[model samples]
Target: MGSTYRLQLRNQAKPTDPKHQPYRFESVLKVLNNGDEKLKSWKVFVGFRNDEYLVSASNAVLADGTSLPANVGNGTVFAGYPMTDLKTAIETAGDLNQIQVQVKLLGTQFGVKPPNVPLPETIQLANDVHLS
Candidate 1:
């Protein structure tokens, strides 16, 4: 048994036809649990789900028991719009060692239905929220 945290990504945006590019996002985290410290981040390949991407500081299992890689992508780039905000938050955190993450698109809404549960209405609203 060890420490575990949740990561979520939501597409809070309406589909804009043309001109507006398709949206994509990622959650980058610096985690510290007990006495161990590490930096871990995950990028959404298909960034439209409003689901939790669970992470563990020790051995943890996905709901389906799928294996996830330890390090997925390089995180050196830190500038411009969305990434700017994400970078600032990561840098300013007083406790980057132990953290949880919930990431969402800036102007969309989403919901989740667990296994065997009835799916709820799709969320559709624009909000200005800081994940801090």
Candidate 2:
């Protein structure tokens, strides 16, 4: 069976509270299965980047038969970056709008063993929001 999968970013937003510490932001990672094959497990590398440097990075995983829906799963809010670093990068680039989020599927399992499914390349998440 021909099966395909893709990663997307959702619920991207910046912190509105002034009391919030050091330029914090939040977003969700969405794993989508478009094909008919039932996935048993999968892993992906996710990160945020600007024109100059990577702001943050993390890994996500899904297991069991919980991979059937179009919205297969959701990843936790990746608070892996320091606000100072992100601010520095933004200042260096001189454009907050240049930052982008991306994800890459590392591997997948159809059953108890590895499948012939080809790993998809890294893709940029659409509708990325800029932090003020």
**Can you give the lDDT of residue 85 in candidate 1?**
17
Query: Which lDDT tens digits does candidate 1 get at residues 21-129?
Result: 2322233322122222322332222122333222321322222234433221211111111221122224546343233223321222223222222121222111122
Off by over 4 Å in 1: 1-22, 36-63, 67-132
Residue 113 lDDT in candidate 1: 23
- lDDT of each residue in 38-115, candidate 2, tens digit only: 222333233222111113333332222223222211221222122211222233353332222223332211111112
Ten consecutive residues with minimal summed lDDT in candidate 2? Answer: 108-117
Whole-model lDDT per candidate? 0.25, 0.25
Report per-prediction Cα RMSD to one decimal: 15.1, 19.9
Q: Give the clashing pairs for model 1.
A: 12-107, 12-108, 12-109, 13-107, 13-108, 32-97
Q: At residue 80, what lDDT does model 2 achieve?
A: 15
Model 2: CA > 4 A from native: 1-22, 50-132
TM-score of each: 0.19, 0.24
